[model samples]
Structure formats: C-alpha cells, structure tokens
Target: MKIPFYRPYIGDEEIAEVISAIQSNWLSKGPKTVVFESEFAKSVGSEHGVGLNSCTAGLHLAQLALGIGPGDEVITTPYTFVATANTIIHCGAKPVFVDIDPKTCNIDADLIEQAITPRTKAIIPVHYGGYPCEMDRIQEIAQRYGLAIIEDAAHAVYTKYKDQPIGSIGNITCFSFYATKNLTTGEGGMITTADEELANRIRILSLHGMSRNAWTRYAAKGAWYYEVEQAGFKYNMTDIQAALGIIQLRKLEEMQMLRMQVARAYSEALADCEEIILPHDSHEHRHSWHLYPIRLEEDQLTISRNEMIDQLSEAGIGTSVHFIPVPKHPFYQEKGYRMEEYPETEKVFESVLSLPFFPGMTKEEVYYVADTVQSIISKHRR
Candidate 1:
C-alpha cells in the first residue's frame, strides 16, 4: 500500500502513440510535434504554440524572444519553483522578488508597483499549485508600467482566470509537461503567444537558432540548405514526447475532473480540522488542482512540518513541499536574496506540505491520504 507522491496517468493510448511515432522514423521534432503544438494551443485558446524540451527552456526562450537581457529586471514571486527565477538569470536579467498573498500563496498584485523600476522589463507570475493568480490586476499593472508578462504556468494547464485561459492572457505563457504535472509528456513544455513574430522567434531559438528545422530541410520538397540566424540552445521537443502530449491533451478534461474530486474529498474529510488550513481558490478562477498543499497551524500543533512528513512516510504515504522560496536556497542567499525580505513566503514555506495527488489516484487511496493526515495532526495537536 505504498502510495507514491505522483504517478502519471499513462495508458495504452500513450503507448500506442509512442509506437506510432517510433514507426514514423522521423522521431525528432516532426509532424507529431507540430500537431501536438497546434492542439495544445487550441485547447488553451492561444493562437500559436512552440514546443520545447521543458518549461525552463520555454521560459528562457520567452525572455530571449522578448529582448530581455543583461541590465534588465523581471519581477516574480519568491514562493515558487526556482525555475521561475532561474530563467530570468539565464537571460542575464535580474529577478526582483515580491512577497505572496498569505491566503493563496501567490504573488501579491498590490505589492508589484513598488518593485517596478526603470530597469524592470517584465513580470513572471507563477500560477502556484495550479491556482490562478490575480491576473487581471497583474495585467493592469503591467499595462500601466509598460512591462511584458511571462506567465510561469508550470502548475497550470487548464487554469483560467475570469473565464480567460491562462495561456492566452499573458504576453508569453509557458507550460510544463513533466512526469508530475497534471498532463504529462514525461518531460516537455510549450510556449504560447498571440504574436506571430514572437512565436517564430521562439521556434528558431528553441532549436539552435536555425533558419529551418530538420523536418523542413530533409523533406522531399524542402531544401537541404539552411542558415543560422543566431546562437541558440538545443531545446526542441521530440516527436516521442509530443506523442504522449497529444494523448494527454485529448484526455485532459477527464483527468482534471478526477483531480478536483480528490481536492473535494480532502476538503470534506478534513473540514472539521482547525489545526490545518486547506488550499484556497478564488471564485473568479478555475483551479487546475495540480498540487494539493495543506498548511499545519503550528500554534495548534506541537509537531513541525518535517515530523508530519516523516510520519506520513512511515505510514507508506508519500508527500512533498511545493517550494522552499527562491531566496531560501544557498545560491540565492549568496546572491543577496534573503528570506526576511519575503515574510509571507518565509511563513508559508515553513508550514506547507503537498499531499499525494494525481489523476491515477483512486478514491480509496485519496481517503487513505486524508485519513493519514488527520490522524498525524490529531496526535500532534497542542
């Protein structure tokens, strides 16, 4: 009865797609990748999509496409995965940290203006735990400040804010298809934008800045010659990964329903507990429910977060923390990012823990996790 933290919702459909891709012989970025990109963009209400090896790669390319470079600054939340800020660093730009809203654990939109300076070029709002951020307010602030928005949508796929899909809202939106994501491609990502020029630039930069991809160059009606417009990284998504993506995209809605069921079940089971706080979702947004994070009320409990995690592990239940805040890491600390600067993130990081959540989880397993959490907290209650 060992429950892993995450298990991909893969089936025979995914296997068949991969086999079809392998049989096609053109396994690199090819027709399957193109179809996957198109379907994904359409699903998210975006005009264009560029597939990449990972969300980190998409973020990096977005910065590059937007002309963000050294001496520029990008504002983002401190309470997010390191990839959010690391991409800014990769673009040779400075990442300005902002505190989060204690309730949603998202970047506080109200605090964004104070962080904006002459050098500030963009805002990267991470949809923390598949919950949509305050996008409308963030967009208004960006518009007033003349800054671009690059959404860190690693935890957001089907997420929507005020009936608008996340991928279509930001100037550049990035999505991840990691093994743990709501919809997985094992390891893949997509960048979506409305601007045709920017989409083309991202495509070029994702595959060594080449004028043409391997598919086009080797096609019977295509030319063998191509040009290098600029130096770029090797970040193209393969046909095999795209094969998985296509299948996953087709079944996304069904998977999301199951995830919501898990969230609801947890809420129903633990509604009476005053020693723990559940994740929050705004009425205006549709949460993708990627990760179910709970906060232990330290004032009501004698045990720390680590002890709870250890107890869950001993009970054959796996759990994890969403993030440690970018500044808490040693590398960021050396770079002058202090935890004290982000009080909300610092506080949330200490109390938060992610429970086992995935589409593949059964009803009994969901209850097992909820019951286990309740039992552990009861024993530790003050």
Candidate 2:
C-alpha cells in the first residue's frame, strides 16, 4: 500500500491524444495548442491565454510584456516555491519580499504598501497551494501604486477570489500544468490576460518574436516572408502537450470537485486533533485545494516535521512540505534575501507538511493516510 505524495491522473486518453498528434504531423505549436489556448482562456474567463513550455516562461514573458526590467522591483511573498520569486530575478528585476498571512500562507496585502517604492513596477502574488490570495485588497494596492500585477497561479487552476477567477482578475496570471498539479499536460503552462496588445506581444515573444507563428509560417499556403522584431525565447507549447491539456481542461472542474471533497474529509478528520492545525479557507475566496498541508503543533508533538514525514514514509504513506521559505533557500540567500526578513514565512516553513493529494486516490487510500497520521502524532505526543 505505498501511497506516493502526488501523482498525475493520466489515462489512455493522454496516450491516445499524443498518438493522434503524431499522426497529424503538425507537432510543434500547431492547431491543437491553439485550440487548447483558446479553450483554456474561455474556461478561465480570460480574454487571452498563451500556452508556453513552463510557468516560469509565462511569468518571464509577462514581465517582458509589461516592460519590466532591471531597476524595477516586483513585490511578492517569501512563503512560496522559489520559482515565483526567481522569475522576477530571471527578468533582471529585483523581487521585494513580503511576509505572509500565517494562515493561508499568502502574501500579506497589508504589508505590500511598505515595500512599494518608485521602482516597484509590479506585484506578483502567489496563490499558495491553490488558495486564492486577498486579490481585491492586493488589486487596490496595485492600483494605488499604479503597478502591474503578474500572478503566480502555479497551484491555482480553478480558484476564484470574489466574482473573478484568479487568472481572469490579475493583469497577467501564470498557471502550471506540472506533473503534480490539479490538471497536467506533462509539463506546460499558460499566461492569461485581458490586455489584447500585451497578449499579442506575448504570443510573438513565445514564438521567437516572429511576425508570424510557426503554424502560420510553415503551412503549405502560407507565405515565406516573415521577420523577427526582437530576440525572444522558444517557449511555445507543443501540440502533443496541448493535446493532453485539452483532455485535462475539459475534466478540470470535475477533478476540482473531487479535490474539495478530499479536503473536506481531511479537515473533518483532523480538525480536532491535538497535534495538528488544519489549513483555513480564505475570507472571500474559493480554494482549488491542490495540497492539503497540515501544521504540526510542535509543542504538543515530540516529533518534528521531518520526523513525521519519516514516520509517514515508514507507514507506506507519502507526504511532503509545500515549501521551505524561498528566502531561506541557498539560491535566494546568495541573491541577498535573508530568512530573518520574513518572519511569517520562517514560522510557517518550520512546521508545515503537504499530505498526499490527487484525484486518483481512492477513499481507502485517503483513510489510510489520515489514520496513519493520527497514529504517528499520538505515538509521539509530548
């Protein structure tokens, strides 16, 4: 009964779709990806969705689209996966770190103002573990500062804050269809936006800044005359990857409904547990529940988070930590971000652990995880 911490829910459909793409002979950024981008945009209520090789690429291009570069600072949270902050650095922009809401592990909107300056060109808010951040307040803050917002929605595919989907509300929202994500395309991402000019710029930027994309340029009836306006990376999504995305996107809401069910079960079973603190939903937002992370009541439990992970592993149940504060990572530390600067992230990082979560897990498997967790916590009661 070995339960892996995360698994991609792929079936024959993914395999068959890839086979169909191979048979179609237009594998590179072809019709399938175009259809996927359009369908994904419609589903998320975004005006445009540009598919890319990875969420990092999407974030980078979003910054490039907004004309953000060196000397510009993007305010963001320190509690996230390093990719969120690293993307800003990749764009040659400085990332201004802010502490998080100890509960949701999202950037504290209250503290964003203190970090803003004339150099703050944008704010990148990470929707940690598919839970929506305080977007209204964050948006208001961005408006007051006249700053653009590039959302790190890597963990959020279906999450909504108030009346808007996370992707639709932000100026530029990036989503990862990574192997362990709610919906996956093996490895790919999307950048959603309402800015048509920005969207057109990103579309070109993703395809090597070509005036005409690969599909249009290589088609039999297409003209050979095309020009590169600027240097850009090859970040276009392949048709094979987009084929999988089409299947996943169509099944997204169904999968999300099940994820919520799993979250509710975990919450109900562990809510009253003495040594665990369950995650909380946002004030006016819906969570996609990508990961069900629990906090160890360190004082009440003799075993540390690492020890608990080891215990879960020994019991044939898998688990992981959502993040280890980005600033604490060696790479960020080398870039001048200190652990002491983000107290809330440091506090959350010390005690958090991500439990196994995916749509494929059976009811019995979920119960085994929950029961094993309770037994381990009880065994190590301090």
Q: Return the top candidate by TM-score.
A: 1
Q: Write the per-residue lDDT of candidate 1 for residues 1-382, one digit (tens) a residue.
A: 3999988789999999999999998688989999999999999999999999999999999999999999999999999889989999999999999899999999999999999999999999999999988998999999998999999999999999989998999999999999999889999999999999999999999888898554587666878887889998899999999999999999999999999998888888889999999999777789999999999999899999999999999999989998988998899999998899999898899999999998878889988988998988888888
* Span of ten consecutive residues with least summed lDDT in model 2: 211-220
Candidate 2 lDDT over residue span 1-382, tens digit each: 3999887787888789989998999888889999999999998899999999999899999999999999999999888888888878888999899999998899999999999999999999999888888888998999988999899999999988876888899899999988899989889999999998999899889888888564577777877788888898899899999999999888888898889888888887787797888888855778899889999989988899998988898898888888988888888888888998888888888899999999877778788889899998888898
Question: Each prediction's TM-score against the native?
Answer: 0.98, 0.97
> Could you say which candidate leads in lDDT?
1
Clashes of 1: 0
lDDT of each: 0.93, 0.88
Report the CA-based lDDT of candidate 2 relative to the real structure: 0.88
Off by over 4 Å in 1: none
